[model samples]
Target: MIGKLNHVAIAVPDLEAACITYRDALGASLSQRQELPEHGVTVVFIDLGNTKVELLEPLGENSPIAQFLERNPTGGMHHICYEVPDIRSARDRLLAEGARVLGDGEPKIGAHGKPVLFLHPKDFCGTLVELEEV
Candidate 1:
């Protein structure tokens, strides 16, 4: 099943502004910006002692984030990630429970370089959920 809360991902129209807000205004420590081409996002992570906050910007026109931004011009919370001991097992359990997995129904490398899978937002009360293997 699900484990600890991994991180909350927020889509931002402007990555630099979002970084400044979190780094300067909120005084948070942020990781260097990293481009995840496979995920079609450029991301920066803010360290939060117990968890992290991920700020994501669309990397290309076809980026899923781009589609999200089109629907929500201002950008907002995109998804919440949770850790799992075994991603495949977790995926199977979710499937058995009638939860839909996004994409090819396989785990992909995530921001933390760990295996991750996204569940359909509609299946989780309109909130996108990500399962990351720990």
Candidate 2:
């Protein structure tokens, strides 16, 4: 039901700075930066060869990223995204297996403009797992 890891999303206070830090300090390269107004956050993608890292910055106080940062100020891993061939089928299987779906009975436009859905963290051993069809 799951394919290769698409990327690891991490919450951060500053997107550009994080990109620079990861670039020079950790040798990660900035692949793209996109603002997701609907989600009230901006995401910067840092390429790491086969995998990628997504840096998320809240655009507003009420944004979920803000709440995430409040819980872990020194922002860290936010979620794990897995590339799925068919989101609906994958979601159905997960639901049949008792995993809680965050989406409301339908997939939504997600980062990279792809259909995406999230499986509740509690269902995945406290790790937020996102399934995306690219």
Candidate 3:
């Protein structure tokens, strides 16, 4: 089962501009940009009091974010992550309930260094959902 809202991920065409918007205009504290080659993204976390905002920029041409950007050049909310106590169990339950998991249906290390899995957008009312173990 899902727990607290972990973070909302946004895909951006310009990582620096997005970081500046959150850091300077919004007065938010942000982490240094981290390249997650495994996930094919370069990310920066914007610290919000209760939750965080994840900014994602495609790391390579094959990156999923690149495809997303191709669909929406302006970029937008890519996914919403929710915390889970047990990722495997949560995945199993989702599978049994006929929900589709993205990728190989396995958990991968996320930006927070936590196990994370992405659910198919179509399965969650057209919004991609990410479950991160905490």
Error of model 3, residue 68, in angstroms: 0.5
lDDT (C-alpha, whole model) for all candidates: 0.92, 0.87, 0.92
Better of 1 and 2 by lDDT: 1
**Ranked candidates, highest lDDT first:** 1, 3, 2
lDDT of 2 at 21: 93
State every prediction's TM-score relative to the real structure.
0.94, 0.93, 0.93
Location of the lowest summed lDDT over 10 successive residues in candidate 1 = 60-69
Please write out the lDDT profile of model 3 over residues 100-128, one tens digit for every residue: 99889989888778999999999999999
lDDT of 1 by residue, 76-106 (tens): 9999999999999999999999999999998
Residue pairs of candidate 3 with colliding backbone atoms? none
For model 1, the stretches where C-alpha displacement exceeds 4 angstroms are none
